[model samples]
Target: MGRLRHPGRYRDERRPERACRGRADRLLALLSGLAPYVDARFSLLCHSYGSVVCAHAAPLLAQTGVQVSDIVNLASPGLDVSTVGELGTSARVWVAQAASDRIGWVPNVRVFGVGHGRDPLDPAFGARAVDVDDAQGHDGYLVAGTSSVRRLTAIAVGTGDAHSVLAAR
Candidate 1:
């Protein structure tokens, strides 16, 4: 349920390919040792650029016999979702976005020859959409006592009422 580290050239200068490769490499190491040390019902909770890493890593991990229970992307840019082809079919995917999110609002067209635009809100993306009230920017997904927090906690524990998950938060 923790975030994965992805190494790259520079935090602000990385190409998508570099990011994906770093994530794929790191996840391979994690999947290789999973059987003896991790839970069978593991899930992925990704945010911002981390979601892109998870997207790249999921299929590779599946090929190694690691099963994911869920893959939640809080504020992700589009990935090669189509190219990867059903990477999270075995996992319950929850994609949440705030209407006011500043970064997400950036038009999901190609940018600087690197496309960082995948609107999980788009019907074609195939993720269950959740709304996060007042989640207006990059760092708001982890806001204490918010819908994002509730959804993330639910995925972490494996079972919870999604219907009312974010009510108290």
Candidate 2:
């Protein structure tokens, strides 16, 4: 997991960006160490800042011959790259954003290297956007009985397509 220190409300904006870069570097190192031991294809399920870490580490992991089956980004703040293809993995990238999630309201632009980048759920980002009907907010996707949780579970286990999951309910 990315060790992003949650700063106080009054902290400088640059602190989070710095923290994210550091965490991404650490995550890349960790993935380099772990890739050799992963005998089978794997998947990544990331939330918030964790998605940013994954985005950075994925290219390096791909270089090590790690086959990533899927990458699920839930309520991501944004990713470091403008396009999901920059991740350099053949993984099926999935994204979810609750209708009521405040995080979704954040500007998707990166300014002065502060914000991460484009929203993953944006059609331009090239990710499969999943429907999160029951998720009420940024954190509600994890709550039991929420449609978001069920849909995510299905995607994680490779049982169904994200769009199909929404249609089934």
Candidate 3:
């Protein structure tokens, strides 16, 4: 229900499951408890490392029929997209990355000696990519009035499309 800044705390090695899972479990349990009081329309807005947490939690939430209305990921490091396909199809999934982002230019994913390539702008990724004209590295996402913020805000409100994400840029 609320925006989680650091989602990976639940599963990342740095924090480990014990430390973070309690909070996540408590949150999920609370959501489950409050599901009857609230409407079904809901979403999980994950940014950066938070996407990883959402990816891990999707299955458990599914079992509870909580229904993920949408997933908005911004300047993400791979959230294991292949695993996401298994996450129910009802939730509208979206992703946005700046064009001039140097950090995302390289594949941040590596597994079993194989690595996934960069495609923050690839249409096949099934998520719209918002473009940024600035050639800055990873943290260029917070430039106030830039296209990145505009498109990101639009997508977050469900008012933007692929073209709108890059409009007038």
Predictions in order: lDDT: 0.65, 0.73, 0.57
Question: In model 1, what are the clashing residue pairs, if there are any?
Answer: 78-118
| Candidate 3 segments whose C-alpha is farther than 4 A from its true place | 1-27, 62-67, 100-102, 112-122, 132-144, 166-169
| Full-model lDDT, candidate 3 | 0.57
Candidate number achieving the greatest lDDT relative to the actual structure: 2
lDDT of 3 by residue, 77-142 (tens): 665554446544556676656555554765755665233233434555555445555525566665
- Order of models, best lDDT first: 2, 1, 3
Among residues 3 or more apart in sequence or in different chains, the pairs in candidate 2 whose N, CA or C atoms overlap within 3 Å are none
lDDT of 2 by residue, 1-169 (tens): 4444332122554566655555666766666677778777667777777787677767766765556688888789888787888878788888888878888778888887677788887788888887788888777877898777888878777775744653221
Query: Which candidate number maximizes TM-score?
Result: 2
| Global CA lDDT computed for model 2 | 0.73
Q: Specify the poorest-scoring 10-residue window by lDDT in model 2.
A: 1-10
lDDT of 3 at 131: 57
| Model 1 Cα lDDT, one tens digit per residue, 93-122 | 667766666656656655665665556556
